[model samples]
Target: MKVLIVDDNQKALVIAKARLGKEELDVLCASSGKDCLEMVRKTTPDLILLDLDMPDMSGFEVCKILKSDNDLSMIPIIFLTATDDTTNRINGLDLGAVDYVTKPFDPFELRARVRAALRTKQLQDQLAELNRNLEDRVEQRTVEINQLLNQKDAFINQLSHDLRTPLTPLVALLPMVLKKIEDTEIKKILDLAIKNVGYMKNLTEKTLQLAQLNSSRLQLKMEKVDLKDEIIDTLDSLSSIFSEHGVKIVNNINSPIQVEIDKVLIKELVHNLISNSVKYMKDEGGITIDGFQNSKDVRISITDTGIGMTHDQLNHIFEEFYKADNARHDRSSSGLGLSICKRIIEKHGGSIYAESQGVNEGTTVHFTIPL
Candidate 1:
């Protein structure tokens, strides 16, 4: 450790330097407070032994100036006094002195105090270095995570594109081929092929959409839209499915509720929730689409008389590819529907959750949209 001894008396400086030098420390001597400050500016010492009485400036004043500087404030200062005066010791300490050493210093006491001060400074420096290293590591890890996510999104997009390229031709030609065929067995096989192709197309589209929703690349196109009209439009689009399942949709939202939202995403949200409800329902049941205006946002609920889920099932309902008892084996369900709905609502700065009593009861899905 480097130690600087500042004293107006040349004899005192020499004596102090000789005593501390024996302890394997680099001892630098200054004849006055001004010289001490000047030397400190040139080379910062780890510890300072300042004489209380000086010709150029008092040790208290020099201490105050050093402590005020952010760069030099951390260097420990020890006041060297001729007498054990209580007031002087307190004033020196208040000015940021680490400890006080009486004049005609004892070699043992001086060396011990200097070691203690240097040890504390070493620990503080170590801690600051650790904090800086931690910050760098956290920043590096964040960049790595972001890169990995981008690569994953790109792979999903490319795969979806590749799958759709071949399915497109089959989707269009298989239906026409089935229509022209007269043989019953041949027509049945072509129809089945068309259905499977259609399923693949749907799966590709949903997977691409889900991947986009999960990534940071997707941006919401916000606009003011009528909530009732959006819900009505979604119901119209899925009208055939509801009819096929013999399910009734009761639109209970009467008011023209206006909300700032991404129109396409909100429509998809309603479509997925409503379609999912019908899928799990019995042959004939009712789906109630209800909404109410609250202070901060609008709350909508889709209640269905379906084969209700248990508490555990409701907990994982929004997870991607998570299927309940019936949906687990049901090929018709891609299981990404509700997961997309959840992402849509969250992107709109809203929340979504489900409530189900138990099996053979019912399920209600609640979602919110900000005003």
Candidate 2:
């Protein structure tokens, strides 16, 4: 422990330093308030023995200054004064002095008080360190909980979408088999039921995929892939859908960029973007697929001339189950397509973002994957 003995009386300072100095402690002495303040600024003592009456500055003023400044506030101060009045003790305590000892002090009592003050300071310092550690642990736990919740939501959505995909064939076949011998009214009711079942199945599958993607469990079998070849393959797979929707597929991927990624996941990403473009187009909009390679990354963009989003809508377009207010009325979608795209991109250690010039203008989705 480091202790500072401050008093105008040189004899008293010597007496206290001699009595308290020990093998485990180092002692420093100051004969005036100015000298004490300078010593404190130079090296902060763990404990201070201050005198109440002084020529220039009272011990009360010194205590007040030490307590007011955050840097010096924790140094334990014990006052040594000749007066032992109740009001004087109260005033010292109010000024943040920890204890008071009378002048012509007993050496044993002074040593005991010094030990007590040092012990209290140690305990207080330990408690403060413990509180800081506890706060750090709480912050870490909060971050972990938030991550888990996001994963849970993603899983539920993926399960629902996957289960719904196989139901499509059943919905169509069941009603056809039962309709042959039914009357016109019965057939009409069956048709309505079949239609609703198909809708439900589509919704379920999309929701499940969204959930799985968001959970960070969407794994990919990675391989070295040529960007041009992959784009051509994806467009070929969706040629029929494009024709039916009267939408044009324009490819400008001139660069022969090679990257390591999951081919199947990339296919799914392209399919979703193309499908969204067709679904939202008012007048047979075209989709442009393009890519370029920079020094450290490959950039891919999907631009569409469809019903684009507002700035606010673009901000949250990738949030799972987050359907725009306007999009909610369109029963054909379950609002998980873009979120799935985002998850797939992120799983590849990439980033995706959308930009639009408001509704009915156009939208461009850009992503960057590290090489």
Candidate 3:
């Protein structure tokens, strides 16, 4: 560090020069406040010790002038005076002097304060540097995330448009050819082939929806919607699936609850959860859709007595293409249903999570939307 000491007495200057002879410091001497200010602009010392009583200008005056300049304001200043008047010392400090030292100075105490001031300045500089670095890192990561999202959008578009187009013709032709077939063995094979194609179609649609959500392409048509009606309509759409699996719905939501939401998206969100419950279910099970409102949000839960997930499975159920161990090899899954549902809920400024009492017990999915 470089320290600049100013004094009107030549003897006092000599004494300071001898005391501040420690290593790693370059000391500069000024005979008056004017000379100190001038040397400061050129030398830009890290710390300054100024005599409070000078010929023309007091140290308080010098402190004010230094602090007024933005470039010099951060430099630490300490006052040196012969009088031990508490008011005068406080006056110097009020003008922004970092510390005060009485004249006929104690060398050890001056050195200690100097070291403390320098250490404090070091920490401040380090913190400022860290803030600058953090800002730069955040900006860089934002650019990278944007680039990745753009590439994901392009990939999903190609998957939906280019790929699904070819599969559509094959799917349509396979069904028509099956209509003309008479052999049971051949018909079964064609039906199996059609099922695989249907899975592919479902996968493509889910990918498109997820990609659109990630790209922020979906705009919500926000309106006050009848929550009960939406749930009933969504369940009605999937009634055939539930009937096929022998899954009865126990809708505990008795009253109508009004909510601000996008009707289409919220319906889809409900449909996905209910369908998942019925999809993995065996014969003779029940699915429940219950809702209630709190002060800040309206909460809903879907509980099902189906093939519940293990802790490991529950952890990854919301992730893309993450099927539980039981359903990992099930070719019917696009592995994107829950992921799409999660994205939809998040878009509405809501949250969703799942809980399970291990495998074969039950699973409950809960979600909340702001009121």
Cα lDDT computed for each candidate against the true fold: 0.90, 0.84, 0.88
| Residue-by-residue lDDT tens digits, candidate 2, 1-371 | 89999999989989888888653689999998899999998999999999989889989888988899999998999999877778888999888889989988998898888989989999998998999999999999989988887777765756665675578578768776665745878777777777677667767777666666656445678999887788788889888988888888789997688999888888888888877877778767799988878889998888999989999998898988788897785667777788888888888999999989999888888888889
Per-model TM-score, in order, reads 0.81, 0.58, 0.76
* Runs off by more than 4 Å, candidate 2: 1-173, 176-182, 216-220, 324-327
Off by over 4 Å in 1: 52-70, 79-107, 221-263, 289-299, 348-350, 368-371
lDDT score, candidate 2: 0.84
In candidate 2, clashing pairs total 12
TM-score-superior candidate, 2 or 3: 3
TM-score for candidate 3:
0.76
Model 1 accuracy (lDDT, Cα):
0.90
Instruction: Please provide, for model 3 over 1-371, each residue's C-alpha lDDT reduced to its tens digit, 9 standing for 90 to 100.
Output: 89999999999998987888873679899999999999999999989999989979878888899999999998989889789999988888888988988988899988888888888778877897999999999999999988987887778777778988898798789999999999999999999999888888888788877878766656888999889989998888888888888889999998988899988988988988888888877888999989979889998999999889889888898999987766777877889989988998898899999999988898999988888
Q: How well does candidate 1 score on lDDT at residue 359? A: 88
> Which clashing pairs does model 1 show?
none
Root-mean-square deviation per candidate:
3.6, 12.0, 4.1
Model 3's C-alpha root-mean-square deviation from the true structure amounts to 4.1
Top-scoring candidate (TM-score): 1
Worst 10 residues of 3 by lDDT: 209-218
